[model samples]
Every structure is written in structure tokens, then in C-alpha cells.
Target: MFEDIIGKMRGDFDIKPMEVMNLQPLVLAYIGDAVYETYIRTMLVVNKKTNVNTLHKMSVNYVKAKAQSDIVRRIMDKLNPDEQDVVRRGRNAKSVTVPKHAEITDYRYSTGFEALIGYLYLINQTDRLLEILRLSVEA
Candidate 1:
């Protein structure tokens, strides 16, 4: 599904994956959070077509730090060496803000997950990104 969208959108802009590699993990995560939110919101709208409030509530189950942490745990071993490197950088990088209500470990894992997502999004690797996103929620 996402593949078709990407095929059409690819010509819309050009990108450099190497440039994204130079960005800070937190900067990657910033874009990643937005990418993830849009993905979840799109899934909700396409799958259920419910009211906005209900969709938002349902999205909470998937977007929370704990959930993200667990999903990243599930997918970590499946990542390739390069992807693992990205996750490692994101996991170990210090952040200025701590999660107000989430465990530190979970927050770190979520950041790693978001970093990967942001990296993929910036590089216009939509197919690979969607593949990872599917792995994220498969269970």
C-alpha cells in the first residue's frame, strides 16, 4: 500500500541518505515522532474510519513509550548491521528532556525506534520504512 504512494512521491523531491546520517539522533527523533504519528493516524483513518477522538485514543495504545519500547525490542534482532548502528547511536545519545511519565529504558528504546524511522523518512526509503513499521506492530 505504502509502496504505491512512494512510487508516485519519489519524483516530488530528492534526498541524500548520507546527509541524514550526519544529523543528531534527537533531531532525527524529532522528525521521527512526526512521521510515526502520521503513520498511525493514517492507519487508523484507513482501517476504521472512526471519529477523531476515538482514533486519537486508539493511537495512544501504539504511540506510548512503553509500547514503542516493546515493539523496538521485538524488531531489534531483525535489523541489519547498519540499522543496528543507527539504533545504537540513538539509544546511547543523551537527550535534554526526560520522559515525564515513562521509564527511562522505554524512552531510550522509543528514541532508537524513532531515530530509525526518521532516518528512513529523510532518505526517502519509504518501502524500507514501511517494512520496519509493519514489523513494529505485527504482534
Candidate 2:
């Protein structure tokens, strides 16, 4: 089912996998932000059919920078060395834009979290990605 949706989105393009390490951390975070929001939105809709406004509010609790930062901190010890390295690289990646609502530290940590998600998705590690996302939600 997941593959079907993604395949349709890619539509006849023979997309080849790129080397994950070559991608910039911000690029990873870009995709990761989308993936994370999609997952959170799906989970919320699946668990409870609420008004869109209510659902959006609920998702904010999970997707906000502070929440993501806290989730990553709580689960850091659970990550493998490679995953940790990815997160570290993401956390250290410099961004020129300042977060309007989040502290710098929280924003950076959230970027690291998103990068991990993006890295896993790019590598086609669905199970691990789902696991980490589940852990983040649970945390």
C-alpha cells in the first residue's frame, strides 16, 4: 500500500537510490519533516476521527520543535552508532534561518531528529523508520 502511493507519486520515473551520506543534512531534514508530519497525521486520523482543527492541534503536540527535541534526547541511547552519527551531523548542520518560536538548541535537536527520519526513509529502512517514529511518539 505504501509502495503503491509512492510509486504513483514518482510515476514512471526510474528513480535510483542516492548515497545517503552525500546528501546535505538540511536536505534530509526537508524530507524528514514531510515524512514525520504525514506519519503523525495518519496516526491521529487512524486513532480518532476528529475535526481537522482538532487533529491539527494534536499533531502540533507531537511535531513541534520542543517535542521532537525531547523525543530525540529520550531515545538517543537506543540508536545504533550509525544512526547516532547521522543525528550528530544533523544537529551540527548550520542553518541561517532563525526559528521564530523555538530556542536554537531545540531547533537544532529537532533537525537532528528529522534528519534521522529522512536518512532511514532514503535508505528504504521502513521497519527501522517506523520503529524510531513509534518510539518518538511513545516518548
Candidate 3:
């Protein structure tokens, strides 16, 4: 499913399995954060038809550490083995500082969620990535 999407995006995009396999967890999380946020923002605009401020508020509500943790708990059971492993790696990753108002658990889960997104994107699995994200938010 993902390969088809990538193929349609442009002729230049190629999915090299070895390249994706070499990515570090932190690098995945870094890319995933941006991908996830962009998806959230796009979804909000398309579904809610709201103003910039309203979109910002809604996006924040969904992307925050606590919300992401809740999402992870709800969807973890549905994830594949590899996805679960990715989440575990992200959860176990060490961060220098915790969010001001969020719980450590929430932050960890959020990081895991971002890592999953990053992993999917890195492998050019855009369809699966979008599907997982949609399922997560809708749940």
C-alpha cells in the first residue's frame, strides 16, 4: 500500500530497505515529530474548517504529551510486532528534560508515538503511516 503511494508521488522516490533500517531512534523521532504535526494540522483544516487559532488549539490538544500518551494506550494493542518494538524503543529513550506540566509517562509515550511515525515515514510507508495516525486520533 505504501509503495504504491510513494511510486505515485514522484518517479524519483525510492524505498531502499537498508537505508531505512540504518536510522537511529532519535533521528526517527525527530522526523516523526514534524510528520505527525503536519498531519494533525492538515486534518484539522480539512475536517474542522476552522480558523488558524482554532486549528492551533485543536492541534495542540491532540499533539501534547498527555494526549499522545492516551492515544498510545488506546492503540497499542492494535499495533503490529514491529510497531510495538518501535514504541518500546521510544519509551525507553533517555531525554534530558521533562515537559513542564506533563507526566514522565506521558512524555515517554508521546516520544514513542513520534518514533512510530518517523519509522513509517522513513520507510516511505505513507499510507500505513496515515492509516495508523487516523486510527489513533479517531480512537
Best lDDT among the predictions, by candidate number: 2
lDDT at 48, model 2: 78
Candidate 1 vs candidate 3, lDDT winner: 1
- For residues 1-139, could you state the per-residue lDDT of candidate 2 as single tens digits? 4444433543444334467777899988998998889889888998979899999999999999999999999999999999998899899999989999999999999999999998887777777888898898884
| Runs off by more than 4 Å, candidate 3 | 1-15
Q: Per-candidate TM vs. native? A: 0.90, 0.89, 0.85
Pairs of colliding residues, candidate 3: none
Task: Please estimate how well model 3 matches the true structure, expressed as its whole-model Cα lDDT.
Answer: 0.81
Better of 2 and 3 by TM-score: 2
Which sections of candidate 1 miss by over 4 Å?
Answer: 1-13
Which candidate has the top score in TM-score? 1
Q: Using TM-score as the measure, name the better of candidate 1 and candidate 3.
A: 1
Error of 2 at 51 (Å): 0.3
Model 1 CA lDDT for position 8: 64
Candidate 1 per-residue lDDT over residues 1-120, each given as its tens digit: 655665466548676778889999988888888878878888888998779999989999999989988988899888988788888788888998998999999999999989988888
Q: TM-score for model 2?
A: 0.89
- How high a TM-score does candidate 3 get? 0.85
RMSD of each: 1.8, 2.4, 3.0
Each model's backbone clash number: 0, 0, 0
